[model samples]
Target: MYQRILVPVDDSDTSRQALLEATRFCHNQHGKIRLAHVINLAQFTWGGAEFVDVGELQGNLRQSGRTVLEKAAALMQENGVEAETTLIEIWGGTISSAIIEDATNWPADIVVMGSHGWTGLDHLLLGSVAEGVVRHAPVPVLIIPIKRKK
Candidate 1:
């Protein structure tokens, strides 16, 4: 039923699983996949260290984001799914917020993402982006949980 699928990817096993699920779903529906990576410049600038050049750091972050998107797109292509990529620069916003915004702007039929599955104290401290996206996204969200190794 989904025509345009939006998948947010990062350099994590959870994200990889999410992409795999998105690929399978898109392949079944003959849908296109949009892979997005958001770079939050605020993370690199919060300390405001004089030694670090913000511009250079942002450039490097953008490059890394591009690489992540490229690899995810390549994987989708290998799975016989059409894929598109986007790199978003965030000055001040949570990653979940950016993803939700992209979903709305892209007008995606659904959002597919991975959950880190943090619970208890870790969940409280770090917060969950997947949870936030599920709460705020305008479109349907499919969360693929990352299996923890015993």
Candidate 2:
């Protein structure tokens, strides 16, 4: 029985699906959930230089991450599952690395997350975070793939 389930969320349909799946799993196992959202401030930095005062941008990103975490936590609560939320700031690493580190440090039994399922040129350009987590996570990771609605 996977008791401690860690879920990483973003503002995406796939993430929503992941949350739903995590909630269902917890409900069945009587487990707890740790919801996390990572804010990658480095994305705002362009060309390896500080182009602007990123303090405000970083603050905004933090707020957004909090919002994402809150919404995920709420979903868990609404499903009658215990949930703890964390907002991770990626000051010096990739988002996937932050998520993997959090999962190891939190010592979760399993990780549930969403996969954008990018392929071909898009996959090469965007580089899948789910792929990174699958490759490096300390625990078993369940990836829920989401398809775009046409």
Candidate 3:
């Protein structure tokens, strides 16, 4: 019984579907869920060093993370699941690292997230956070992937 579920969310449709799935699981299992939104400050600095305002850019990113988390939490509420949320600002390491860290610290029973299911060039270029998590996370991971048509 996975009582504590940690879910990573973004603004993507895949993420929304993952949340919905998690909500259903939680409702069925009487579990709790934590929604996480990560802001990669490490990626931001190099990109912003030349032109963007560091403080403003970071602030905007933080707000965006909050907004995403809020929306996710709302969705959970609508599904009759009360979800806790955290906004993680990572100065280093990949997004997967942040998620895994939280999962360990929170001691979640499992991690539920979304996967874009990119292949070939797209997978090579974008890399897969879900893959990284599946390989390294201490607990079980459930990924809600994009639906394929028959």
User: Candidates' TM-scores?
Assistant: 0.94, 0.90, 0.94
For 51-139, candidate 3 gives per-residue lDDT tens digits of: 87787888888999999999999999988899999998999889999999999999899999999999999999999999999999999
* Model 2, span 1-150: residue lDDT tens: 899999999988999999989988878576878999888787778664466677788888888888888888887788778789998887667889998999999989999999999999999999998999999999999999996789
Instruction: Give candidate 1's whole-model lDDT.
Output: 0.91
Model 1 lDDT tens row, 77-130: 888887989999988979999999999999899999999999999999999999
lDDT of 1 at 75: 85
lDDT of 2: 0.88
Better of 2 and 3 by TM-score: 3
Those runs of model 1 whose alpha carbons end farther than 4 Å from true positions after fitting are none
Per-candidate alpha-carbon RMSD to the true structure: 1.3, 2.0, 1.5
In candidate 1 the C-alpha lDDT for residue 56 amounts to: 92
Q: Report the lDDT of model 1 for residue 85.
A: 95
